[model samples]
Target: MTPLLELRGLGVRYKGAVAPALEGVDLDLAAGERLAIIGESGSGKSTLARAVAELLPQTVIQQGTVAWPGLDQKARNGRDIGFVFQDPASSLDPVMPVGDQVAEVAHANLDMDWRAARRLAVELLDRVRLPEPALLAQAYPHQLSGGQKQRVAIAAAIVARPRLLIADEATSALDTIVQAEIMALISALVAEDGMALLFVSHDIALAANLADRVAVFRHGRLVEQAATAELVSQPRTDYSRALLAAHLGLHA
Candidate 1:
């Protein structure tokens, strides 16, 4: 089967930066597969996500192509690739009701009418396990908890049912328990919808638990890519080994 999404020799450099944020990064995400890009701060994981989503800042110079099979190449926006940003509150508009914001995506992408779009939004909120989807739909970004806000953001992303979902530290802000629930929700959604997931996080343990394959980045380069079990049990590079050791120590 053709890959749902592919990134080839991808590179991104911001103006005035001494080095590129990402360099020669290659990734292929098959339908229904979960791939994790894991590394510490400044490892270029988020940069890769932004590049794939075509959400990078204008100051950044990007190279290479992000191709999605069965999707129009011209429609490179949030509608094409769903992005659950790291900060859910900031990703949402403060003035707009959560339902309307979510409905907008459905409206824009699917040409859904207001009434139909709102119903779809509510359904999506329910799909993400948000309690009282109707009530939550009426709430503003400030009215929701961090986890709730994140759920709302995810609901909006999936409203259009995009083929690829790029989550940039989507669970990092939540408490451990909430993180687990959110991760489980993400896993369920991807499996149920057969959507390709690219999860970017600094937490290797979380990545290992959530991703089918883990790709490790160091200084803008992907140093290793392997099955989660293989990468955790038999890391190839010294850097990867050290990262694993650190993760183990943290858990210990």
Candidate 2:
């Protein structure tokens, strides 16, 4: 079977930057497979996500081929890519009711009428296990907690059932309990839909729980990639060892 996402010699650099945020990175994500990218801040993890989604900013220069099944080469927005941003509150509009914001995506992409679109939004919210989907549908971002907002984000991302979902540090802003909840929710959704997942996070333990394979990044370079069990037990690079040690120290 063809891969769901493929990146070859991927590199990104913003205009007038001293160095590229990412360089010479290659990755493949198969349908129903989970891949986690772990690295320190500014290690190009998020950059890789944006590049895959074709959402990089105007000032950035990209050199690579990102092929997705059924992607509209003419209109990049129609591609089968969904994104769950790190900060839920920032990703949502303060004024619009969360449901309406989510419904808009379905309306725009799926061409559903307003009523049907709204119903789909509510259903998605409920699917994410939000309490009182109808009531929450009427609420704004400020009315929801951080965890609830993240749920709403997840709901919106999967509303269209995209083939590939890219979550960039999605659980980092939530409390530990909520983080666990969100991770479980994400995992369940991936299993439910069988969509490919590209998860980017600095939390090794959390990522390990959800990923089949782990790819370690260092200074924008992909230094190591392996199965989660193998990589955790025997990291090939010094950087991977340091990252694993840091995570171990936190719990030790």
lDDT top scorer = 2
Give the clash count for each candidate. 0, 0
Candidate 1 local lDDT, 1-252, one digit each (tens): 887788899999999999999999888888778899989899999999888777789989888887777565644465667889889988999999998899988898888899999999999999999889998899899988999999999988887677778899999999999999999998888888878889999888888888999999999999999999998888888888888878765221
What TM-score does candidate 2 reach? Answer: 0.95
lDDT of 2 by residue, 138-195 (tens): 9999999999999999998887787778899999998999999999999999899987
Q: What pairs collide in candidate 1?
A: none
Query: What C-alpha lDDT, on a 0 to 100 scale, does residue 58 get in candidate 2?
Result: 85
Cα misplacement distance, residue 210 of candidate 1 (Å)? 1.1
- Give the whole-model CA lDDT for all candidates, comma-separated: 0.87, 0.87
